[model samples]
Target: MVSVGDDAPDFTAPLADGDVGSFTLSEHLEEAPIVLAFFPAAFTGTCTTEMCTFRDQMANFEDVGATVYGISIDTPFTLNEFREQNELNFGLLSDTNREVIDAYDISMDFADLGVRNVAKRAVFVVDGSGTVTYTWVSDDPGVEPDYDEVAEAADAASE
Candidate 1:
């Protein structure tokens, strides 16, 4: 697993916001501190609440010029709908290929649901230099990260 001070693994994936676009992590690096929030799936109860909480707390991230992206195994179309429904200001990255999850070492399996290669609930704050500044990962999908803690990490990364 990636730790603080480790170089954040860069990857490119589909961006699902209002439009179907592509996002390259390396391209966004150096522009601002980046928050990569990886969730198991979209439209689920815990995922919805977690994402909505981030949506509501977006100003804290924006104040420090940090960019946030939620990642999941869902396709761009599903993520676009999820974004619109939740009114999420940040873009959602579609990791249908599971490359990002694999690279970050946050892949989880939901054997109960028969789902495989889902992203475990994890958050990574990457500074402008593309080095990880903070990380929070939970094996239990029901658990969410501390928003204030993540905001502080992003603020520190901005400096």
Candidate 2:
């Protein structure tokens, strides 16, 4: 994973914007605060609840002037289905290639972890300056982040 003081590694990947499209971290976060919440995959129970919580609290983040988006190894097609099914209001980035997740060093170890090329669940709060201020990682797959901590930190950092 990128470090606390290091620049947040930027990458462009396919996203579910109506259909499968491309989006860049630097571009999306150019002039706004960005929150990239990484999950393991789509349609999984814990992942769904975690993302849905973000959906419900999205306005809070926006109200504090931060743009929130979710990132995962799932394809845009699956992401589209997830968004439509769950009514997610933000972009669900497809890191199927694992480029972005790999850059963040959040990709799971296939041999030891038993899941080949899955992303570790994480949350990163990047300020408008493209610096990551807060980073949260779940110890295991089933755990959900404390969104309140991240949200509050993002709000404070954005200011």
Candidate 3:
């Protein structure tokens, strides 16, 4: 996991949110806290649970003035289907090229373990200044993050 105060690599990736057309990261970076919830893949067990949890708690996060983003290595087509099926209310960014993951140094070349070139499941809380204030990467995908803790971290950092 990245330490607090590290600069989150600035990169623009394709995003599709509901009917919203494809856009870049800059479109959503202003005026609110950005929570990049990086999951391993779309439609997987832990990933689904984690994303749905974020979807459920989105309003609460917005009430506190935070914006959450769901990012994964899934193709845009898979991401679109997952978002529509789950009724996700946030931008699902496609890092299919793994550029963002590589830039952030979160990419794992786990070919030895039979899974290759997938990013680790992680959450990065980036402030308006684009500095990382909080980061949590699940060593094992089964262990989802405690949403409340992430919210608290965002709340505390925004103050």
Query: Which candidate comes out best when scored by lDDT?
Result: 1
Q: Write the per-residue lDDT of candidate 1 for residues 66-120, one digit (tens) a residue.
A: 9999999999999999999989999999999999999999999999888889999
Ranking by TM-score: 1, 2, 3
63-82, model 3: which lDDT tens digit per residue?
76888988888887788899
Q: lDDT-based ranking, best first?
A: 1, 2, 3
lDDT of 2: 0.86
**Candidate 1: RMSD over Cα atoms?**
0.7
1 versus 3: better TM-score goes to: 1
With candidate 3 superimposed using the best TM-score fit, by how many Å does residue 7's alpha carbon deviate from the native?
1.6
lDDT value for model 3:
0.81
**Model 1 spans with C-alpha error above 4 angstroms:** none
Clashes in model 1: which pairs?
none
Clashes of 2: 0
TM-scores of all candidate predictions against the true structure = 0.98, 0.93, 0.90
Per-residue accuracy of model 2 over 1-159 as CA lDDT, tens digit each: 686667989899898965888888888775467888999889999999999999999888988888888999888999999999999998889998899888998877546757787788899888887888889887588899998898898788778
Cα lDDT of candidate 1 equals 0.95
> Which model scores highest in TM-score?
1
Instruction: For model 2, state the Cα shift of residue 66 in Å.
Output: 0.8
